[model samples]
Target: MKNINNIFLYSALFLSFSVFAQQGKQKKADTLFNKFSFVKASKVYQELIQNNYNKDYATRKIADCYALLRDPRNANRYYKSVVKQENVPVEYYYKYAQSLRGMKKYKESEIWLQRYIDSGGAPGNNDFTKNVNFISSVFGAKQQYFLDKVRFNSKFSDFGAFEHDGKVYFASSRDEGVSTKRLYGWNAQPFLDIYVAKAGTRKNVDHTAKVPGEINSIYHDGPVTITKDGKTMYFSRNNFTKGFEIKDNKGLTNMKIYRAHLVDGSWTNIEDLPINGDDFSTQHAALNSDDSKLYFTSDRPGTYGGSDIWVANINEDGSITDVENMGNLVNTQSAEGFPFINAEGVLFFSSDGHIGLGLMDIFATIKGDDNAIVDIINLGIPINSSTDDFAFTMNPNGVTGYFASNRRGGRGSDDIYAFHREPVLHVEGVVTNAINMTPIEHTKITLYDENDKEIAFMHTDENGYYQINIDRNKDYKIVASQNKYIEDYRKFTSKNLQTELITIPTNLLLNPVHDVAKLAELKDIYFDYDSHEIREDAAKELLKIIYLMLYDYPDMVIKIESHTDSRGSLSYNDKLSIDRANATYNYLIRGGIDPSRITAHEGFGSRQLTNGCESDTDCEEADHQLNRRTHFTVVQME
Candidate 1:
């Protein structure tokens, strides 16, 4: 019995020791994760899961690690384990949805995304849920860009291409041949440095070399923009500069934008920008066309997300002021950074917050007439992928450019890729009435391809103007229609088109149905003296209207008005005119016209005389005969 008790005691001691050891390991893994060391933390979390110690928490952490590392395949695998577990946080559902999207499982991603939304996961001001068909629309769009990986890419991260003076400048994590190699803990990669090479489209040439300057440090650096004169430079670097490092309260070093001057063909005079903060990151500097404004990414106080695009006015003395956020239209509740402003002032940036195919997708800003950002358009496919795609830089020609992506088949974790943009085709015109030449507002415009398949549709603006993007070298049909008007169908071909934009010179004209109904020339039906019955001549005139309403315009509606000559007392004439109008209404109904088509049948009682036929006045008998008649007027036509 004593031996059995001893065995129990030994077992308990061993169990207690194991629990303490596991707790210690969990604490260590959490510390590493907090420090942004996802690669190391992931391994530790996997070990904890193998020991079955706090398996749920460890599983979630492992998934989070893979997600931060942009490894959606592994993240999806691990997230599947805990997403269905009891009491799991709702955010895991959102993360799992993102991972599925990274794998191009868009339908499955939508299901999990719906579940996340149903579970009360707040997505802020983004309209992902509102636009349920956005994914389909994105995939349905034409391919805009063709990409080719640059040959200089190493087996490490090589991205952020910027062009100046016929040379391509970029950032890379390749070995620098320093005696003591320093590495970033996030992905176990070497510190980033600036490199330069001759700018060309050739795939076999590799003339990459480090920038000839003291710009590099033991920490992260590079990804730069130079002024039009090639005298001033702005770049991103770790907070460590001037032989010291600045860290936030969490002991994490943030990024900062620095300025440098080019002297005698070498970059020097390095200085950090005043907009940077020790507690937050401010990097990825870009300049507008005129160099009067500087654009950059920052996570300072007023940001709507992890980071947001910010603009500052450039002073005459190479300083910045009047910093402003780009607003919610360009930023969301997730990360947005790497802004690149083109010559036309179009803002291109990368975001994980907006609706995208996966982790980080590139987007372009659509500005209003006031130059405020009104909307954002996804750059869709080839330019973006299921992984991080950012640091887009466009050349002056606008057709050819470079961007970076960590997508599949890359030579490294991230690679710089040259891209050629295909020319886009657009058809624009105004819709107007054929008879009166008046602009027809709210006309429905539909576009159909050669296969007669409806491709897109929209309503014309208040000014009767419409514009639609079409595919090059394809036959298309545009149909414009409005209420009470005949539809106008115009077929055109974009085949062999050389220009990007074409304005249809001829306005789309819709003929009003009322104009066509006028062919009936509805003559008045006269009545004999003191008679409220229809004559043969009256029946002949009524048949014209009946035939048109039944065979020509079945949806037409009309009203009947009857008048009497001034021969009897006012009350008698009024009663007689009403009976005449009612007779006409009944005749039309009996002739197979829908009763609802007759909007009204009323008597004027000699109030609307066609001539001076009052009882006190001497007028011709023909004028009196004209007064005793029933008239038809079209009220509505569909």
Candidate 2:
């Protein structure tokens, strides 16, 4: 899952073997391997394997070499041969899994993942166990994105997409000139260089041009970050100056962050960051939303892992201070880098340590109210793969974003992909009382899908309002409940609309069963023609009465009053309306409303008509329908 930054290929340490008696050729191969010359080391190791001398160790070493070179084909072949051996390290299983993933063998990769876990890899990390299940769930989830290759991608590695000031800036290894053609040993690709292109539709994107000569160095210089105003810029480059490279204790030159100021429509006054160090790398710089803290990936001392995300405070004078590791919440024993924080404070980064679908899956971390990382969620499929998927950036809206990956179907090595998240509908509303329309605070609300399956739950705030996200083209049943009030229910649907935001004006008005007149305020329940059964629409309204009597005031008594129109004969109307009232009483009892609470069932035969139509059609159909209705009143409180 390592980003193939060829300029600093020495950062990847070669695997060591136990010293033993060997021939001259084997000794020379070990020498090359120790010097971190994986390309030469692999050749010698292969020769030993061909001769059946030190076959086991040589096979392992060659596999490691191919892996270091990012050659998945050879790595997979060699790993498959020896990975099943009992003496093989647990890491071999992981490497084999990554290799399979690189080849788009997802199911086979999953088998190796199980082997890695069974071999005690990352013991006691429950997140690793959950990650296996999370990957499966991700594949079955509704597709949330539509991906397309970015137009500016080159045949070489092109990634790290960022937008600022009407231009898109990214890192590319595309050839510029013969002078800038130094090759990186890892993938044998030219060193990365920052390129700026007009940011627009594919048809209008200007051919990408290299940045000013001051920014483009012979070594790696790319993956830039800009302030909100697009004035200040920070980019990654090898720690070299004046035609000489800075080497650490391991004889490896590390990457460093550099600052550049925008002046007169060009980047000028370029300088190295104050935090640069020779012992470790500090690259992939990013600024928080308010520019208060600068976030970057570093392999410095005191790191909890190979590479950790560190943050430094940006003071008023623009000097950085108080650099601290983001801690284990974001870092692990494995490499984690390419940190990007959006305006919403959600941190997105790539990691191999966290259990993921593949090698380096992108993860999102959101902090809780206490500023602790509440959840570290893997951004699953299409955004992540078994291959290296890092260097993610997005616009303010978050509907569209870009990330780089070496997964299959790419235009070339590590192609940059543009993706847009499908719109997720938001449901927002206020919970208020029906009588005085007063805000109901702290009301528990549960959201369920059409099949009555619960989706999510929340409590109404002090302002009597709540909001939650729901999927589009789905029907939801929202149930609002409070201890002292009658519960309310609403049926809502997203209806296949792809709008950015959708608000449902659901106001739950609960009538207290203690007040008889207030209970009567509920709309009259109507029955079908010549039938006493509660229709579907009328049953929904009846749920309020049932909830009030059963939940709010279990012992409170209520009377069911069924009225009949003036059309039927007096005796028949009386008998029919009585049966109708009894039917409603039975429905409530079946719904778990206490039958004891229903104190009375009475039918009035055409006696309480407001239209005053006696045995004649003097009133319109609307008036007659109103006369044939059911009403409930509280007969007792407490």
Candidate 3:
């Protein structure tokens, strides 16, 4: 019964607003129509004309607002309206034509644009008209425009998109929630849980939630952030387990900031934020542009409104210092929630209190000293509809941004949507053989970080093509290899690699290793001078030799031979190289090789490598590596 009255009240309010609008009278409304308020202001001008008032300037003001607002819908409406009521300003008619062109009424817009130029419309004022003409002439309407939609089945609504260490961290109210039971006292749902998933997985949906079992009790447990190493997770969980003082009458566990350490890839020992904190709801967290400080929303005391956005200093220990309310420029008497700081230090938050297009649309303003805002900007349509759109978080590079929306045609209640920040990098390329430029099949393309861990890997199809989706300023290595080809390695240097339609195509020429013996030429055996003590390098070579012999001829037993130069006495050389062979034999025995399959050493002494010994004065060190050697020749075939 009481809900009926509230619905009636909203309906009446909407009707009243449609019936009347006063020009520049509302204090806050005048403030928000900042630069583009021309559309609403133009409506007021139209009202004055309807009232039979002498307001020729108001008509032009309407056109000006439409021009600045960039809304072809209303821009065309008032453009025609102003011309019908008054002689279209020779200067304004070109803008009207531009508006028409924006609406795709190109023929009509073109006719008016000509008259506008003939009537002495200045080039500067008609810049918008010229841009419209270029769009129609140069790039036709059929030019591709894409709308990327993310559809996923979520247990609970998802929000707070953060990418750390190449994986996406987000908060989801899912069936796999931390709390299986709901809270009866506050009538709160047990859905708000934290979840993580691979960022760009388009196949079979995986909604596996990775929340610590202990911290995610039967309460609100999410809206989380993860450290770069994924070792520390900072999340907002309701109620303290030890029972700290909670000022909010709702519930003690309703809102609090908590941190937990990730040991062995699992979260442990959850703790609450210490400084600049209260029992009140300290929820809705946002990291600063540098991620040095965190901005969160709370309805605690000392705030001018229902909820105030506060900034807290982030400590190395994951503790935060006394939080300061962003002040009047950032907060208002109305609910101000969901703070987001972009790379430019511009502050973005959502509020119905601030004069805006609708309830809960995002707004941006330069954060100034004394909490004063400079040039507050309202996010335009689609991004900002008459519905709730909040909880925006972007990665460090700022090329791709994410926001939560229940907007429509989604898999679940409130699935998260990702968007390309204008000028996002769309990196695409191809891989080919360096020699012939022909497509190489089955070539593996792996992308790795500085730590040499593979982030993504793929095999080239018949065309030998590979594409990588990457952010800006990150160092990455592209290694391309095929079954028999030497790997083709290349590196893409860091530049302004941030754009949505970026095309950086390259070829990966993989050189095939046709020379089989040249493979791993580093595999060598070396011996000590005048001694048969098998060096560790030589031992390793013998080990490989044993492995290959066993692999290729499973039933073969071979004798290992060690040789020395003529400088040594035959008897001395015999014992020296024999001990060398025996040392290698011992190594093989220690390596789990069969003792039964072995034969003793055969050292031929100085006769083995005395190719020039009969007349030689001396031999270089290079000859030494060759002279002191170990070899395996198959002796007995089992």
CA lDDT scores, all candidates in order: 0.78, 0.73, 0.59
Best-performing candidate as measured by TM-score: 2
Q: After superposition, how far is residue 203 of candidate 2 from its true place, in Å?
A: 5.0
- For model 1 the TM-score comes to 0.47
lDDT head-to-head 2 vs 3, winner: 2
- Clash count of each predicted structure: 0, 0, 13
- Model 1 segments more than 4 A misplaced: 1-140, 201-208, 424-638
| Candidate of highest lDDT | 1
lDDT of 1 by residue, 123-222 (tens): 6432344543332232222355778557788888888899888999999998656667788999999989998888874543222477867677788987
Q: Per-candidate TM vs. native?
A: 0.47, 0.49, 0.44
By TM-score, the candidates rank as 2, 1, 3
- lDDT of model 3 at position 40: 50
For model 2, residues 196-284, the per-residue Cα lDDT tens digits are 88775474222247776478787898899999887888999999776788989998889999988888878878887788898999999
Off by over 4 Å in 2: 1-142, 176-180, 203-208, 425-638
What is residue 580's positional error in candidate 1, in angstroms? 75
